[model samples]
Target: MDRDDETSSTPPAPAAPARASRSRQLRLAALLLLLVVVVAATVRVVVATGPPTWDELRERAGLTNRDRLIIGVKDDQPGVAQKLENGAFEGFDIDIAYMIAEDLGFDAPEVTLLSIESEDRARRQARDADGSFVTVDLVVASYSITEQRRDQGVTFSFPYLETEQSVLTLASDPRQVASLRDLERAKVCTLGTSTSEQRLREAGANPIGRNRISQCIQALYDGEVDAVTTDAAILAGFVGPRPPGELPPATKLLRPKELRHWDIGAESAEKWGVNTGPVPEMRDLVNLSLQQSAKGPDGDRWKAAFDRYLASEQQYSNPQQVAVGRQPEPEETVEVRQWPWERWALPSPGRPRSGVPSAARAPSRRNRRSSGC
Candidate 1:
């Protein structure tokens, strides 16, 4: 035992401070690790429960993985919905389908149009040229929204057009059909599964059910039916100026003079809605698109369609029979939650002006302009 042994025996000059420093380092490391874990968990939760994205919405509504957005539309109805010779679809309903498809992230080429008859509208089924039953993502076939139809499993979006039921006869026909009673005991052609049939039955008229409005018109042309009854907007379509040879020689005879307005109650006004099948998400998404179209900043797309397709015929039509000119308000409100960063997307607030109350500085309350059905 020499000096080295004596120094060792002294316990290395009190190492408590170094031991305490090491303990603090270990604790700090543990604290940092815990903070990182907490941060990671918080990020995971925010991402999981965050606001929905458009892609997420599309996926949830089952639009993803599909090659195209298949929309069911009438192959013929003149102004309301129709297929063109170029294998493309045109007319108001087709325009509406395009608008909805655009909002749903599909281009014109990405949309496949299949002809859908009135009876098959609620079932969300359409037919290709080959007559194969094709499933469609939406039906924009001048579908009228009704409680009975809703109960029957047809989920409707917001009503896009409002037109009253009316009767159309050949211009050569001299009979005045101002009311349903006028059609009593007469064979009136109407689309099957349409409100027109029920209404005709109510009026003690014989409703000749057809698969399409074109069929009804054809029946009238063939003298197999006395009159064709449906939404005035639809009748206006055929009455409007058509390309030469667009209609049958007989259907070309439908003139404004022969159109009769019932001028009935709310039950007679057909509020056309997009059939979104049974998916509530799809319904809500379509409703959102309609809401935007009806209330967007620039103007109403619905009005544009109406003006382009049905407005001209209004002068010849009974003023009361024309659809309520403006687009109807959406039935449901859509709440799109914003992401945390979206707050930054908005303009940043400046400092409050001197002596101005917060409420006074806020946007003034302005009554929304009145709109009809």
Candidate 2:
């Protein structure tokens, strides 16, 4: 090839394109760094502020904008309803709800009694997309806190009170059954949908399911059943020492196991207990209310109410009190002496050394001679 053709065929360097590509990459990196800084600043601001205050959270929940906060309460029971009538709703839970509403600048909440059957409670809560009911803001029933229900997308607050399963029997009966084993031969009755019935079955006791706890208690009282099983707290309320002349001479209550007690919390299922969904905000709100209620004046007031109504009834005389009787006097105390350490003495050829050092303590003659002391 000619020298001119060779010079023309040699490829020109692509330095300009390479320099432009490097410059573009640097610009992109700088832009990315700027975005990271902006995002970091925004996150810092949000974290520094933390979540909204309880009052702010309640207000943001839109409770204040509404004319009234309606709380749904199950109407099938007399305990909660009776307390409501006696101004207990005006007491702890209700008072807390009202305070939350008032802080948000809303009117005192009006409690709406809803007739939610024991079986349908899960369904009612699922219908509301927001935590608020289209007809009420929240449910204040004596709902039990359970993991199975929680999995159904229901939010529950910390427990307000602790209740347990108890066996209710007649006061005059000679057969004092302290456990399920003791009641193996006796007839046990419980409500159809009650946990007490299930517990009895688990304990190996044959339980006859009835419609309501009241019916079971009636059966026990009338001798139709040997014992009635129900929540201890409710039983305590029912058997509360009847006002003079109310209950006959033969009525007593006992609680054999205290560990069976369960805590009560406010709960609502999503899709009516059909599906699990987000309830973090609602759960937080209820938990906040429960925490607040558990402390301060509200807690004391409710405790007093519980003591007055339920605790008094649980004071019934236990048959075991008469059977086991007082504990026998403790065995007389006995004195003990610690063992002494064994005494040891080194053996000497004859008598023990007086002033002379033993052979084991003698210095080497070679060392002594070398020292020339």
Candidate 3:
């Protein structure tokens, strides 16, 4: 073979540095693509697992749009829930409303208490101080949780208070009303659309429906009705304090001395719950607040409220029955999802964990802890 043919057959070698540079550039490009994919996947996972924001919680609880929380409460049901002369509400129900509102991130001033009648409770419509009708976020009135009420679109939290039917009559009246049967064929005044009215009908009493319990009380005083029937706690409020000096100004007109309290002695109890109206999401939030109140170390709101409003009235009411006014153990379980930072921020065992999804199934009656009321 000729030297020229041999030289043409062999290709010239490229520079080593140039070859190395091209190889390095390919590897670097692959690494950068891989890094981008990894970062994107990590960001997606974190977002999906992250804890809910405060605004999200309020939105889910159906209170995001409103700056203040409006609660429906009874203005006339004296120790259970009543309006004071200073235009403030003070009572057990009012205290309970405060507890729930605090848990919901509202201050005392951010809560608006509106007067709600028994019939309007299910509708969540309350009358403001100016007599305008406003929709309430919650009904902390002496609202009983019944299956029928649930069917009617009222979603309630777990029971907070358990009471039984009671009758209040004029002390001067000769009727000895120890049980429901004693009121048979007699005209009894009860709030319309109330559990007491149904019970009165079952006991063969003629129930006259009124807009408010106060109206029933007035009817009883005016000799228009034989007695006013409702929960014992409410009746005890009408009776006021046993001591003359301790008599609440609101009850002075009721003439506590002339009011007679009769324990109806029923087997089943009226389990009072916070009415959430049509919002089912509010149920768990309310249940958790109540659970904290009953069990948490930092949560003595329920006990304090009971002592302040209902404790002293036990003298005029049924001591045994009134003793059961203790706060109920929440029946439902609450689960919350939180970030590591959130857990570290709130280390107290009493603080409710936030953001975790709860169990969907309701606890069976057999598995539920009894409130002993």
Candidate 4:
């Protein structure tokens, strides 16, 4: 009778623990299957995206950073790329920099200018007051495209403007020295490490080495140096009409009637071009913009820049004021605009030396010309 009663108790519902364990096992199996499915789906999505295609990479390459481009440039250059009093940059080279920024899909405000030296163009880096490093993305100074500079690991754009060497002499000087040959032993101011130095010395000039072009100008105005010599475009900036209290703009051009403006010779007819940060793609892009400026529509950008900033009697052209690689007589009348120097001046009127820079007056004409030849 006891046995029948126990069997009729439903065997304690097949043991409560056994029932619970079977339910937990079923849930665990389902979770594992779900996790595996999710992992497979994620891998498929990753495969679909892959790496960015060439087109996308090309777009990103133009951006120096998230939203702006840092360009290295010379600050004191008057006609090429002067850093203006308003903290804005102006000149033919400045215009070129802006155009390049635009072509790379950047706007005016999106570009940053770092004042650099002519020597520092190849290695683009500077230290801030806080001692951090600042690297330039592009360089648009009056940088000359030379084989030596090219070997420095920086790539240059196609020749956009051709610059020729020329001389600036006093208008009142009775000598009226017309050719390089006439400068026998006269103190001539020229930049060191430049071909102008050798050429001036060869021409029998007592070359006065100045670090920046502005110094040479100051020296000439102060009568410290008899003459200032450099690229014609550079000299033209000073020869235009001027207001009182400023350096006399009535300077004379003692150019030869040979083939070109470069007094140094065929090699001296150097092409002023843009420099890229060792970026092969950037070289291509810059060249394209340069080409468009010369070959594009009526309102060609480069032509417009030439009209506004570089124009006068000595305006720039694609082929240049004088023929490249040839010595020629300069035009009889060169009409350059003599705007006030202080009007849209550079951030640093003087080129940078070992330390900081702005224009400081030449050291009291340390070596004044005692006699003129």
Query: Which one wins on lDDT?
Result: 3
Q: What is the TM-score of each candidate against the true structure?
A: 0.73, 0.52, 0.76, 0.61
Candidate closest to the true structure, highest TM-score: 3
For model 4, how does the per-residue alpha-carbon lDDT over 125-215 read when each residue is reduced to its tens digit? 6433365658888888777677877776768777667767777666555555556667788998877655577777778889998766777
A best-first ranking of the candidates according to their TM-score comes to 3, 1, 4, 2
- Candidate 1, residues 1-373, lDDT tens digits: the string is 8999888788456888999999999999999999999999987886688645555666789988876889998767766665554455556787788777767767666778888777788788887868899889999988888999888887889898888887777778777776888889999988888888888898999988887777777667678888888887777655433333332221233312333334434354689999998877787678777877777532455676667666655655554456777888877667544455753563111111122122321122121110000
**Residue 161 deviation, candidate 1, in Å?**
1.1
* Model 4 weakest lDDT span, ten residues long: 364-373
**Hey, what RMSD does candidate 4 come out at?**
16.4
Give the runs in model 1 whose Cα sits over 4 Å from its true position: 1-51, 243-267, 340-373
Off by over 4 Å in 3: 1-55, 62-66, 242-257, 347-373
lDDT of 3 by residue, 1-373 (tens): 9999999999778799898999999999999999999989986786677544444656787677767888998877766776645566667788788878777766676778888888888889988768989999899998888899989888889899987777888889997987888999999999888888888888899999988777788778778889988777777776643333222324234322367778767777888999976655576677767877777654666886787777767766653355365777788666455556765776322244342111211111111111011
Model 2 lDDT tens row, 132-213: 4344455554455567776865555455555545565665666655565566756788766555666677667778987545
Each model's C-alpha lDDT? 0.69, 0.42, 0.72, 0.57
User: lDDT at 129 for candidate 2?
Assistant: 25
Error of 2 at 224 (Å): 3.2
